[model samples]
Target: MTTSSSDSTSAAASQPGRFRVGVQKFGSFLSGMIMPNIPALIAWGIVTAVVVNVSEFTEAGWEPTNALAGVIFPMIHYLLPILIAMQGGRLIYETRGAVVGAVAAVGVIVGSDHIIDQFNAALPAGEDQLGYVHMFIGAMLMGPLSAWLMKKLDAVWEGKIKPGFEMLVNMFSAGILGFLLLAVGFFVMAPPINWLMAALGTGVEWLIDNSLLPLTSVLIEPAKVFFLNNAINHGVLTPLGTQQADAQGSSILFLLEANPGPGLGLLLAFSVFGVGAAKATAPGAALIHFVGGIHEVYFPYVLMKPALLLAMVAGGMTGVTTNMLLGVGLQAPAAPGSIIAVYVQSLGGGVGNVVGVTFGWVLSAGVTFAVAAVILLSSRKRDMELGDQFSAAIAKTEAAKGKSSSALASLSAGVPSAAADRIRTIYFACDAGMGSSAMGASVLRNKLSAAGISDVYVTNKAISSLPGDADLVITQQTLTERARPKEPQAIHVSVNNFMNAPEYDEVVELVQQSGDDQAVAAGSEAPASSAEHASGTRTAVEPRVLTQDRIRIRAGSATQEEALREAQEILVSAGAVTGDYLQAMRDREATASTYMGSGLAIPHGTNEAKSSIKSSALSVVRYDGGVDWAGDQVRFVVGIAGVGDEHLQLLARIAELFSDESKVAQLEAAASEAELHALLSGVNDN
Candidate 1:
């Protein structure tokens, strides 16, 4: 997992040079023949056998039988190699060692044939006999011989050999080592496999000659009707995995040992005949099919275009048949549905191995390629029409989540598309106008200006003194109270450290969409309360009756008078200077400052008991800013007086908000009433 991207790139760059071009392709084809299911090849191979045996049947189904058989099987033969190369290249990427092993297995088959040919040439002309025993000897042992030889070569190259590809290097490590192993393998295993292959071949020939020829038409006809190649590759085989081996019995063992799906077969076929133009999309498709560990990737591509499907199916069936024909069987399952596990199973020579496997893959790839090419060319128009659907399907994923959100869905003409324009704004507000009021405004203005949005501005003047238009409105909860009815078009932008984050952009997009949706619904519902009557000002959003008897000023313990005085100063510096008006407060204090203990307080006047604030709200101000509290530094303050009992629940949220340690710090250190206001409206309260 600790992969350095640089290293992986370099390694991948050097990978192709390891194998000569065609070797990997031909190797994949030959090795697959020894693995599991191959649908396409079975389709065509059955046809081929039937065609050669047609004259023997009393009824050949007229020329259609011969014509179909001729047309299908031959087509498969031409495209098989393309299918092989594609799948083989993928294997090379994941584990080169396994690939080398598979290629060596191919050599075994070739070596076995080579040995037999040498023997036949040596036989005296008059007595020469091409018999079942001769071929069986060569075929039976070829698989293991190839495997063991590959192992031996790998060993010698690692032990005695060194770097072979660099300039001045021997370059003889695996090659020379393999040649030696090849010689020893041919001597030890070829004779027996040759005889075995010959015997199996003859047996199959006799079956076709005597009984199969007559039934070939009937069997293939029904096969084509109800269960073509896909049924074998996808239908019966893939479902077998949900029933993965759990026990030690032969059934489970077989399930594990055999290749489990036909996914690889289909992918191979796509690569084969999907046309040069289609390959642009095909490589990504093939990789997903190969490594995503899903077999369904290629199904639709094949279904819409059978030529591709046939190429895969033919290669698959051919590989399967050859494996069985060669007596190669899996000991456990492997992905890419290849027979690499047979060595682990040590399931040497059987009724469905070498001959079955080798032949199956060849036929499967070839047939699949042929079918895919035909279907692709036929459906060219349909592909064009449905092209956009593919992108839509992929867009909803995490990989495309940003893509969809970023895509300009319905930008208005010349009205600055989201893609074209990035909107930014800064709101400036202060109560009455002075010290910290100007400080908070200065900080925001400088930050936004540094970001190149100097067009934005913030101010501390009363609404009466201020201009009517602007973009954003940053003010204290109390200041917003004094400033009313201006810049109705401005956005309530959140003031935070990250106007630069991805999430910020996402939030902006959401706000934009929400604005649009709200605009459409605006015709039905009128705007809520205006600035004077703005019920939803930051927090405590509820329909205020604006009834009488709601006190405005918040006070804490008399023991903390010093802390209150400092908080008063901070709030005052921020332009929220208290105007008591004062003497009215002194006259009322004879009764109480509303310091209702347990760290709570409410200070108010007799005359302005119904002191109207925009919100019938709750406020908690800590006097760490300084308060004269009977020598105690009052740590928390709650100013509350509700017109009705309904507003009591609002105190609960206010208490919870004040209880948080982070909120306490911000409240305690507030530079001005307006800074406290901005903090709440921008985040803490929200």
Candidate 2:
């Protein structure tokens, strides 16, 4: 399938402007540093909640001097900041970068503490002492900066170190550089960051005092549609909110951006007064946004008719004003802005606090719904005449977010009715051929297999490698535009999450019905049952490719790269491939993700590295905690070195086994390597 050059060019020209893209990227980066550390923050919040009134627990025979109270200060003052720095550093330079970044962060932390103490001592008699300044801002700055510098330094000495002395040189060089960065952070970074945080806090206090904080919704609501919500919430608000929470036990700053009220109101309005696809999908979208806490679901509705943004802003202001008037706030950041999370965080303040927070969100949601309903009703006639703009708005939302989300895919317009019969080959396309696309392909393939549909072939590829003959092309929403030009004749489906999307079920239903219709038209017998159509013959031969030694169970957790290396090492030891195949495997992953879904990942070398293979073989390892495969959980890693089509039969058998939910659970719960190997070998029986 193909599109005309003119149509493709026009579509490209209509993409979100450069400035919006830049802002979204910056916001994503900022949130990236904080998002990974949220679990730690949550842990701290829990501890704080428990110790807020330790005296209350004494009635239950709890000791007054409960040592658990000590965990509160160290976690916020030291552990969290360092973890954020290490994560930021890891993003820039991996492990070595993380080490250096941590060293630099410590310097700033200690320097700030010392400064605070000195200021307290110098104050006039009986004056209030300044609170300790947490160095989160300093950590965010120094972590990445130090790692980048270390990366540059390492680049300069690349290939210069003698083979045997490499370790010594590398260690000393990193140590010396880390020492220098530590001193630099203490002297240069801490003071400015401390001052900046103080100024920002003062500004926020002024706004609250002047009753102008609600006006921030004008900026926040619009920025959220552009996908800047994370940057504003985590990057700017979380840090400030944490400080206020530390001093006063709660902070309204956390409620400002994390409120789900505005998004709920907007989605409700669409459900009640919208037209066409927008109206049809709104009710479900509202469930996801308000209950599932995925606010991105409602972004396209606003984009479809931008005038609706006024309703969002009004709702935001109402929520803020209500919370402010009630003097209610959360003890911690309410991530995803879910009502459930907000209530959980409000628990420490007792029932009155909970009621106030609840009332605030309800009032905000009501106002937003009222305003949006009016706007939608006023434009209903014009909207109906103008036709459905939901699809275009979805595209714009994807463009702004810079990725396709499975959440949005559920709400996207369905595949054209006619395309169902034409879809014989379904290709899941992504930037790299490895990750979500492979997972989506595997999932759809399993469905087809179970449905007794043998004619359809499901596969995955990088967008650049998509074949023109593709009958159906599935991609993340962000990549749909790029994919259309490559296979314009094929039906294009955009999804945010590939593992589980409602669209996949709709596609399956369509294909099955289409097959039934074709059978009726030909006056032939109905299609065979699922059991009758299942492929592969039961084999008596013992498996040579999967041996007991090649299987590992309960392997400890490791990063994606580490797990990949371990898989390749097993293959190398078996003489299936040369050591160089590891790099080729990495190159293949770099080109596209290799995640096959269902808690499995198959990492293999690229076509160009075929010469490195000595024989066909497979290495399997089970990670108890699961490997983080490009943000997806992969419990089983299978490293492959195939010679021609020799491994295809094995792969098919494995895929078939994983397709069964009960079998996947068994694999995860396997007690030993031999037990795991026995389950894997059983694939040949089918």
Candidate 3:
């Protein structure tokens, strides 16, 4: 939600020690398992809302019954926890651990009590033995602990157990341990754990009854901004709220942390009263945050203006107070805070609850919008400057760190063999496909539209469901590992920030370059001459030397000689020039450094060294980490391994590309070799 880098470990790693990083990674792992199941949680919420609130006709007359509860309650109290435990176990120690994790979770379920005395009150005296244990919390704890314990056991038993008896030993060990843990949970821990939960639930109920629950937003609003909303809601609030729901009819905690009204209000304010790009982006963010139920979309907006935090707190307090005063609370958690999901979850509270939540939503939105508008209007000049600074920061991130190559030889001779045409569809992937990735896709889609680029299709997908034909895959740095293996052939681009505008702009330019290349191929029905290319520099030099494989986009060389040698390797591999050409180039560089202005450094051998060249050729290398060319900081290194006057025309084309700083920046940020080759192919076609 905040504007910090999205790597799961970044916040933890930013702390002063290794302990913090380890804790962060562990927390992130658990979060990964939990966040993907929000849809499942919503379904469970719907079931709870309907089963508890709705009644149907019976044989005698229309009456209420808990029959429908039997169908889904077991899933909430048992199956879901086991599933969560299995997932956590698998994540920690693979299949063996997963099996053991589910077994161990059963112990927690058997020991923990879900209904306790609440069931006695619902039933006639002495006949109230019916009670179910909600094992979600216990399952979360026991699953990982059991997996870790089993892992240790396996390590100790390794090579000791006979090969023939290994399976028997493994199965008996898990079974015995699980039985022992179950006994301990049931005999010694269940009562105390259930008591603690009951106490917490009681505190929440007291707050609601006393009409002091609105004050809880002072803590809840800030926690949500820091990405702790999921942990708070699912781990603490939901379980407590569910226990209360079982006792009474509903719990106010369900609506406390999940009210999307505050975010919706802030976005409405930004859309109406904000200035520049922030204002333009707010309307789309408002739609996503409100109807789509992704409250995260507005967090960065608040973070950008810290004063707007007061607005969020005010909105949250207003919403909670309104719901409390109306005596309305949801039967279950309304995940994602989406309006539709909230309405479904409010079924347990009947018409009053629905009206109350709706009014609260409007009230919070109105308060947040009014407060935020005043903040923006009062600091218009400062807000505009900060907006520009944010954009600049994004641009710097997109430009990464690399030196641009000075090798013209690869561009002319290697001649992008085949990689240019392969990439067409670009995918933006995230942990959950529905939230961040969708917003990223929309951003890029709009950018492409503005650039008048129609052929390229930009879309979003979950990391697991990545498509086969995705020519390029974009994901946050942490989740890139998941997206890469699924589409190994696709060009992978990882960024720390998905919402950064400059990152989207870079991707758009790349797609545009590819489109231009496609147009070039279509218009000519053949590879056009150098003059007919997009950059408008005609060249007589052969295109064979500048193959796709020879063009290195975003190479990480630290110096001029290193860049030149890298370029030489590409040329030699392509059979365009001899390896000894590197030496010849060095001798020429010793005479005078080839540091050209406009972030270009043209490195080449003297005329005398034409004997070392296989033929007249050029190699184009873009270095994102600017290399030191004698005294100049060079970004592009065009390696000239060509012989005689034939290479002169190619130099002209290189000069033309170097002259335009904007185009040079785009080339420097190119995500793949194909994109770079496409840009080169379009050089004179423009």
Q: Judging by lDDT against the true structure, name the best candidate.
A: 2
- Model 3 off-target regions past 4 Å? 1-30, 36-43, 52-66, 113-133, 159-161, 385-686
Model 1 agreement with the true structure over 1-686: per-residue lDDT tens digits: 00011122244653542332233333323444323323433333345434544544646555766666556423332222223322332222212223333343344445655775777788998876542121111221333344344444443433233445432232344355445544654465555655544554455446434533222222322232122323232222222211111111011213221322344445454455443334344555556544543333343344334344344444444444444344343322344433343222323223344344445444544555555566665765676676522222221121111111221121111122222121233334332222222233433333433444333223333334446443344443223323323433332222211112122233234324333222222112222311111112333435331111221223333323223333333333333234332223223333223332233343322334334222233334544433443222345544332342233234333333443557657655666556655444422222
Backbone clashes counted, model 2: 14
lDDT of 3 by residue, 1-686 (tens): 00123234354544533442343345556665555555666666666666655553234322334665675767677777788787776655556666777887777677665335555567776684745557666666767777778767776765478759967997899888777766665666567666676677678768877878888888889766645455666667876776666556677788888788999999899888887655767787788777877776666566667788899999999999888888777776676678887887787677887899899899998998999899989998886666533232222222111111111111112222123355466777754343345445545555665787655656666676776656777776555545555675665566544443344554565565563555322112322431232223245556664667667766565655468767787777767677667766766565334554577665666545556778755677777777766545777777766553344344444544554578777777789879889888743332
lDDT of 2: 0.77
- In the range 220-284, model 2's lDDT, one tens digit per residue, is 99998988777788777888998888888888898998888888888888888999889889999
Ranking by lDDT: 2, 3, 1
Q: RMSDs, each prediction?
A: 29.7, 6.6, 17.9
Task: Give all TM-scores, in the order shown.
Answer: 0.25, 0.74, 0.55
RMSD of 2: 6.6
Model 2 per-residue lDDT at 126: 96
Cα distance off (Å), candidate 3, residue 200 = 1.5
TM-score, model 3 to reference:
0.55
What value of lDDT does candidate 1 attain over all alpha carbons?
Answer: 0.35
